[model samples]
Target: MLKNIFMLFISQGVNYLVPLILVPYLVRTLGAESYGEFNLALSIILYGCLFIDFGFNLYTTGEISKTENKEKIRHLYTVTIASKFLIFFPVALIIIFTVNNVSQFDNIKSVCYILIIQMLSSVISTVWLYQGLEKIRIYSLVNVVVKLLMLPMIFTLVRDTNDINILATIQSVSFLLSALLLITIAKRYDIYLVKINFSDIRSILSSASHIFTGTISVSLYTMSTPIILGLVNTAFEVGQFSATDKIRGAFISIFLILSNVIYPRINKLKVDNEFLAFRFIKKITMIQFFLGLTFATAIYYSAPYIVINYLGSEFQESIDLLRLMSPMVILVPLSVILSNYVLLTWNYKKYYLCVPLITCIFHFSYIIPLSHYYGAIGSGIGILITEFISFSLLLIFSLKSGMLRKIYES
Candidate 1:
């Protein structure tokens, strides 16, 4: 597991680096206003993607973990693909028409369309399938290949064009290519593309309900920032916040890699060695805490220089937000891992309700208002507070449920 985590980290690390390297070039070329417009469109498309995902990624992973039956897995994959395609078309059309009819964000309509296409391709890609099966090598390879291909395209096209449409085109192409690569790999593994099983669709949907809600809530939290910023503040503000966000997001990807690699192992441990599972959780949590704290501090202190140097002087304002939100860099990972742990343990349903509920409340009640008043700093504080609340709640629940006690006894 550790080795896999390490490799996945390297893979994602490369992926993260590409964006960091590209941000400066893109920002300098596109300017803050155009960048803001681009990010807003991306945010809309992202939410669209999340809506279409419908929690199948999590559901499929959990299902795959339970059974290695190739036929069943194939059926689940086929059903998921068919269901996603069915839902995606309408969702994509609604977004394009609604946004176009509303006539808002007129400047970036084409960009939004390209992003929707990217989202559709992303769903078809079944990238999560590789993660579900613990095929980190292929997963990592695909990720690195996409990033490598993107580097040249971004440099050549984005820097020269300064056209948000071109940037969107590059993104769409990248998604299509990555999806194709994953499909090829899946085929090579003899994961046949079976026909859709509508009968199983109902079962899949029922089992996936909570996961869907939780995932949607999470996505809302993620995509809401740009939307809110775009609505309440100037485009420049959105650009600044989005730039800072991209950096923070890159750091958070490390934790994502850790959680993804560990989730299946943790699930297996829950079935095979319950006591060991608790101990494992404790150990990883401690390590995550220190790692989070260390990196948060480093980023907090270094953000000003990093932003100014990498993203240009126009984005220097991002430093304050980065510093304020740096602590969340740690809490976010801890919260995610704990949430996954809770879900895999006995109280799976409860796990879904806890964090997402708190997070949703936190966003609306505190984060949104604070961000409105204080700008990006307020948003950072809101995230910090949200993660802190989530982490505390999960810890309390774990202790009260006797999972922590079991670890101690063992």
Candidate 2:
């Protein structure tokens, strides 16, 4: 577990650094307005990736941890890959139609289509297979290699606003290469590509459908922020919001990566002795709380400095927005633990879905109305509000379900 954590930490470091490096470069090269559009496009593209993934990362990983049967694993791989491929077509059509319909998508419209190729690459990547198997080295290596390879190309190819398509192309090609490499390495697992059928795909989907239900709500509240911000405000406002949000996001990803390490182990332990899982959760939650609080404090206090000196004055308005998002440092871990670790893992899909569903309703209500008066700050506040709401909902649901008691009293 420690080794898995360490490797994933390194993997996450590479992931974080690439975006950190890109944000500044992309912002400067594209200009604030164009960078804002880029972030919006990326956010929407992330939804594409998420849908194609369909919660397979969690569901399939858990399934893999439970079995060593190569044929079963192969079946899992085949169905998931087939499901992803089948879904991609309709999603692509929807995106194309929507992009063409919205004139705001005009400048970078082609880039949007190009970005879908990256999503397809993500579908083929077998990182989740290694993660569940506790063989994270290959997953980490592939990510680092891809990041390293993309670094120079990004610097060389993306020179101006007009080069948005070129930038998208570079990212897509790098992603495809990485995915293919992962698939090659995954051949060792005896993952069969030929034994897939429609029923197999349907079975895989049926099993993970609950996860997808919760994920859709969770993903909506997450991905809707940029969309709403773009709709209610100017590209400039979106740019500032995106810049600050990226910083807070990068920090929160640390806790998320920790979850990736623990999730599989706990699920495995859950098969034999749930007391172990509960104790594990408690110890880790304490660590997460401290790390989250420390991060929130550092970022809240340093928000102004980060926006002005570090990101330059083009992002000056991001200062207060960053401060508004500081609460996520603690809220993110709490919500993640409560919602994912307890709610979804326990198959309590109703309560799991409720937290995000209600949170999304509250967020949309606050964000949509408030953005009219308050802009990006309004959106940030809405996020903080949702965090509080989700934490409260998860706590209440977990207590009623007895998962909370197991964790605390065990």
Candidate that scores best on TM-score: 2
**Lowest lDDT 10-residue stretch of candidate 2:** 188-197
lDDT of 1 at 394: 75
Which of the numbered candidates is closest to the native, going by highest lDDT? Answer: 2
Residue 96, model 2: Cα distance from true site in angstroms:
0.3
Per-candidate TM-scores read: 0.94, 0.97
Instruction: Give the per-residue lDDT of model 1 (tens digit) for 1-410.
Output: 66677778788878888888888887888888888889989988888888777877667776776678888878877877877787788788888886687545677788898787688886787855776787766778887888898889777866643468888988888888888888888888778678765777777777777887877776666678777767666677778888888888888778777766677777778889887877887788788889888989899889878888888888777888888778788878877765676544465567656668777777778766776787776766776776677778777877777666765565
Would you list the clashing residue pairs of candidate 2?
Answer: none
Model 1 lowest lDDT segment of ten: 343-352
Stretches of candidate 2 exceeding 4 Å from the true structure: none
Clashing pairs in 1: none
Give the distance in Å from residue 274's predicted Cα in candidate 2 to where it truly belongs.
Answer: 1.3
